[model samples]
Target: MSGHGFHVHGPHDHAVEHAAHGSDKFSGNIAVMTAILATVGAMFGYQGGATQNDAALFKNNAAIDKTEAANRWNYYQAKSNKQNLAELAMTLPGADAERYKADVARYKTEKDGIKKDAEKWEASSAEWNQKSDAAMHQHHQWALATTAEQIAISLAAITLLTHKKWLQYTAYGVAAAGIGLGAFAWLHVDPIGALALKLGMGAAGH
Candidate 1:
């Protein structure tokens, strides 16, 4: 699902329909699980799309700020060149040295202001870039969670077909992993990195 769009997998729906018709505890349970997983997957897909859009918007903002910063820097450079020219004029034998000196000072002041503006825009660009990266990371996490949910649903379908006990267990495990990934995404934590850090800390403690 993306934006206002919604979709259902035909195979999963067919499996769900078959499960719903059966008059057994196993079929009923599988049906319910599939339904729940479908809902969760839809939600995760939507969140993934939203985060991706946010990342793009933030990246665009970063580019705009970067462009503005470049423009300001260019303007600052122009002022510097003018200031240098004025200083050169001040060195001429019959030039109005005082007027040229005043011009140089004015250009210096203008350059300072432009430089400040450029720096401010550069900082803003960096902040936006960071936001873009964060949103992109969240999007990837949601995508992973959604993929896990999809795989779980597929496994559940296969279990329905084969009536295999292990397939059901595998589906449950996959669904749990999906939920864990979603939680990590919600908390803005990198699961792999966090796990690595924890292991490293435990090792160092010894």
Candidate 2:
């Protein structure tokens, strides 16, 4: 994971120049290591893409729910205004008290219905918010997986450049870490709760 692959051997290092880059065995081994890294990179890349798609979909849903909730509140406000007008009319003199009373009663009934609808919308918005948070958690998991895989690939590159078998072994360790991250992403297991942090772009109930 570090950029320290250019380590230089001491004075006698050139003694092994006979087995330099032209050796078939060395080339073959480096090629194989590269191939393995490529395979793992591709798999993790696909997983990252799919995770992004899901996050986008959840964000869209959250937006829609929040908009609907706002609309319901607006409707509730309109009903309240009408109710206020009706009550004011009832306070005014003689325009047929019965008609004013009837209007007031009608407005009150409408307000009750509007109140219930507004409350329902609010509840629905909250549910959508919870769903969005869960999706975001998964998105973070995928991000972690992708990061690990990228580091592993870099390590593999160093392995090829330095022709150090130990570097390749270190690459394997990094690759295993990447695989572990992928497994955690797939299983939705974030023991540290770090994945719960919001990306702020796709949050619901905003």
Candidate 3:
């Protein structure tokens, strides 16, 4: 009978291999989490930027409407004041009474036309205000939704980094809640709603 010597590798190598495998698994998990976070962040950023641009546009439109309204009002007021002054001058027993009367007639004609135009602009101003307000409100809602989504995504990323399962689940739940809220806001306050308000206001001559 011949006996063969048996040798076994030490446990150190096995322990090292186990640790290496565990590290690889952890790295893979982190990579997946990072990719998800990046994708969500990008989406939120895009929506946020769009909302901001829309808000700016609405503000600019409102400003323009207000300026036009003011100008129209001022023109009417100036015309009225000038007509009054001309009448007062005519009564002053001055050498240029005939000239004053002619000036008064001219002013009256010009003022009548300006009055009609002012009324039209006033109606337009009211319509514009309604439309701009609606648009601004919609943009604000979109901004809020984007902000909520951003917060949820950030929380999820933090949970993933810390390997907190419960926290991660909570983060997902919050994200779902945010999505629902965003949907509700969009439904209630949208650009279509703004456009409809504008059309209705115009038809009503507001």
Candidate 4:
């Protein structure tokens, strides 16, 4: 099929008619396999896009929270400076010491509230950062799975062209790998990270 001034044809497309009329079933098998791979690849691609969007959104939220935290901290610093000035006034010869003490106490209370608010925003930012990291990791997994499916589809095309039984089997293997990766992504498991953890533990044991 061609669309948007681009023509797309697989190697199998050229041999499809020839293989259909052949006495063997290779053509039919490759056709079915490619069709299945295409369907699965579409699903993986959609999931990848969704997770990527989630990652971006979550990261944006994290940035917003971080900015809020910074603003609160800046406010807290301003309050501290005012408190210091009040305390300095308490030591001055002509200043009302009692009024300066009250001001100092009020500023302490305000600073406490600001500090708590800043800490809450920092925690929220950290939580959002974690979620973004998770979504990005899942997006990578989906992308890798989609890549696997594309490779399988390519192998299917080549198998149809060369009629190589080995190529067909290889395509099936790659398709299975794609499915496995997709499953891991769906389950929110990072296989590569798990493997690394295991290896690190083993090394530590040694």
Candidate No. with top lDDT: 1
TM-scores, all candidates, are 0.90, 0.71, 0.56, 0.92
Rank by lDDT, highest first.
1, 4, 2, 3
Cα displacement (angstroms), candidate 4, residue 50, comes to 0.7
What is the C-alpha lDDT profile of model 3 across 1-206, one tens digit per residue?
23766656322223233334666564355345434544554565566566556656756766776677678778878988998998899888545888888988988898888778777766776776666666556556656665665666556555545767776677667666656655755576465567899999999995
Error of 1 at 150 (Å): 0.4
Off-target runs (Cα >4 Å) in candidate 2 are 1-30, 194-206
Model 3 vs truth, CA RMSD: 14.8
Candidate 4 on 7-82: residue-level lDDT in tens? 7665445445546676677788788778778889999999999999999999999999999999999999999999
Error of 3 at 2 (Å): 62
RMSD of each: 4.8, 10.0, 14.8, 2.4
Per-model C-alpha lDDT, please?
0.93, 0.69, 0.63, 0.91
Better of 2 and 3 by TM-score: 2
Q: lDDT for model 4, on a 0 to 1 scale?
A: 0.91
Select the stronger candidate by lDDT from 2 and 4. Answer: 4
Give every collision pair in model 3: none
Give candidate 3's total backbone clashes: 0
Q: Which candidate tops TM-score?
A: 4
Superposed by TM-score, candidate 2 places the C-alpha of residue 187 at a distance from the truth, in angstroms, of 1.0
